[model samples]
Target: MEKPLAYRMRPRNLEEVVGQQHLVGPGKIINRMVAAKMLSSMILYGPPGTGKTSIASAIAGSTKYAFRMLNAATDTKKDLQIVAEEAKMSGTVILLLDEVHRLDKTKQDFLLPHLESGRIIMIGATTENPYITINPAIRSRTQIFEVKPLTEADILTAVDHALADKERGLGDYPVHMEENARLHLSRATNGDLRSALNGLELAVRSTPPEEDGTIHLTLEVIEECIQRKALTHDKDGDAHYDVISAFQKSIRGSDVDGALHYLGRLVEAGDLAIICRRLMVIGYEDIGLANPAAAARTVNAVLAAERLGLPEARIPLADCVVDLCLSPKSNSAYMALDAAIADIRAKGSGDVPDHLRDSHYKGAKDLGRGLEYQYPHNFDNAWVDQQYLPDKFKDAQYYQPKATGKYEVALGQQKNRIEQWRKESRQKPR
Candidate 1:
């Protein structure tokens, strides 16, 4: 059986590698390793189709090392042990373990001894964050190289190479792909080369053999083959900004259905975690003291989503989203801070007013830092008029908590005390 297009087109040497100019290019670490004929156990960390596995294969192929491959998704600890035992017999062995993050802690521990002793040069590939998912001890022993997604130009070069290679690709198929169609495929694949090539192959295969024997690919054909239309919430595209704007506005407008719809769109399009985090910020910025619980709830929801990890965590996120939307709305705190910052920026830095300066340190009293500062606790009502602000803005009121929800009751009590204090203080001889 013929190999898949992505596999067939895999780079066999460093020279053939398409992307990752940072690492695999000239004067790079990997290039040095290849030239020196010295290999180190390393972890390739990144999103899918970033040439993690291909890099490993190219290293094994170009060098004299005995190469072995395994998938963490399927392989057991026993399989690793077996490979390790076999690698011990071979002078140098290169073990490529794909999806290494999927291996549980106990399973991962099995390779620790072999990796440390240099019994095998391990190359691990993982899409997940290795810091959280992999065993710390194992991770510490492995050098980590991060691979990035291919750029549009890189993908285009790859497509051109694939279309021109007669033995390995569909050169005989007279298919002329439109620029729009190519761009659509690049966007839809989300920087995954395997996905893009698979998409191209599908588009080519589905096109009927014509009289001229030429297959012309249009945007509609590419969209149809891919099935999933590029969404308005693509993380790397302009749509991301527009969708998030809509989501925030919907929540601010108290349009629950609209908010939920936008939220659904973001969640389905794999931007839930980012959305949840933004909602947490919005809770504080938009809701503020009017509903202090809104910020706390949103923060808890983000934490829950992080700990629980998807589908299950979506419930908590949804709950926070609803609570934030329904909560008593106020941006008074946001406005207050904005005004404060504007003043600070315009004025540069102001002197610390003596009464508000640090007073606990030795000799502070001689400097008049706390010379006449009143102790509110010593007064009858446990309240006293004091100069807390700077001399330049002595009566400036930045944080005016809105009278809404729980803050309403608290603000009422605070206002009564302030009025009483003012009446007594004013009656006193100046």
Candidate 2:
């Protein structure tokens, strides 16, 4: 059985690796390492199908080192031992460890010695943020490099190369892909070269040849194979960002029809994940306290859409979009939070008020923590205002309630009542 086109077409050397110029380009880190022949263990983190494995293999091929691949989560410590043994026999081996963030302590301990001895040059690949997911022990031992998504041009270049390569690609097949079909293949795969190549191969093999025995690949055939329709927005293009911006602004402006139009465009593009994410953000960042229930409902809708994946997911997503568009909008909550954050950033976060400091600890009383605190629950309304904010920000007011909905209107009224009470109390206070 023959391997897939994507596997066969993997870049055997750095020159053949598409995209990621920041790393593979002239004077870059990887290029510098390869040029000096002083390879270090490094982690490549990024989204799927973005040349992580290819870069690892290319490095090994360029250096003429033995290359081994393993999964950090699935492969055991025994596998690491085998690779370590191979490195001992061969002097050095480049090991591409996929999902490196999932490396258990046991396996990590075993691999550390080998990595330090320059026996196994580990190239860890993961879609996760290694800083948050990987242990410091492993992170300290290796340099980290971020792999970026391929652009449409890069995908086009890769696809064109695959079509022209006689030994590894579909060059033997008389494939005559339409220009539009080729462009759609580049734009629709969302910067995934593996997906683009797979879609291209599937279109070529599944498509019937013409009367003259030429395999004619059309846009429709490519679309069917890739399971995505070519939309006005190229997934990586400016128009895609425009559609998303329009989608959010329409909802924020309470333009139901406009929001729905943009939503349909996104749905047609088959970007359910983006739709769900944007809707949830709009729910809180736009609707907010003005229509808190609507925001809650939007969250429910997002959960439903995620649970019921696509086509069916679009139903709940549409329902949520309509609900959010019709709901009263307010940015007051986030704006106020932003104001507070700006204050903290500009004039550092002052210490917590002494009264508000923790009082349950053994030495808290001696330290005067909570000594002057007035427990609000003991007061009438359970809302006696003492000093909560640090003395430096005694006059700082971050929250400005907007009366855009019944709920916010009530909150505004309560705020006015509290301010009046505070004013009266201040007039009589020492």
Best candidate, TM-score: 2
Model 1 Cα lDDT, one tens digit per residue, 144-192: 8899988767787788888888888878789898776776676556578
Q: Compared to the true structure, candidate 2 yields what TM-score?
A: 0.69
For model 2, residues 343-425, the per-residue Cα lDDT tens digits are 98988899998889999999999999989999888987776768778777879999999988888888889989988877876
lDDT against the true structure, per candidate, is: 0.79, 0.90
Q: What is the alpha-carbon lDDT of model 1 when measured against the actual structure?
A: 0.79
TM-score of each: 0.60, 0.69
Candidate 2 regions exceeding 4 Å error are 232-249, 276-308, 327-430
Root-mean-square deviation of candidate 2: 6.5
- Itemize residue pairs with steric clashes in candidate 1: none
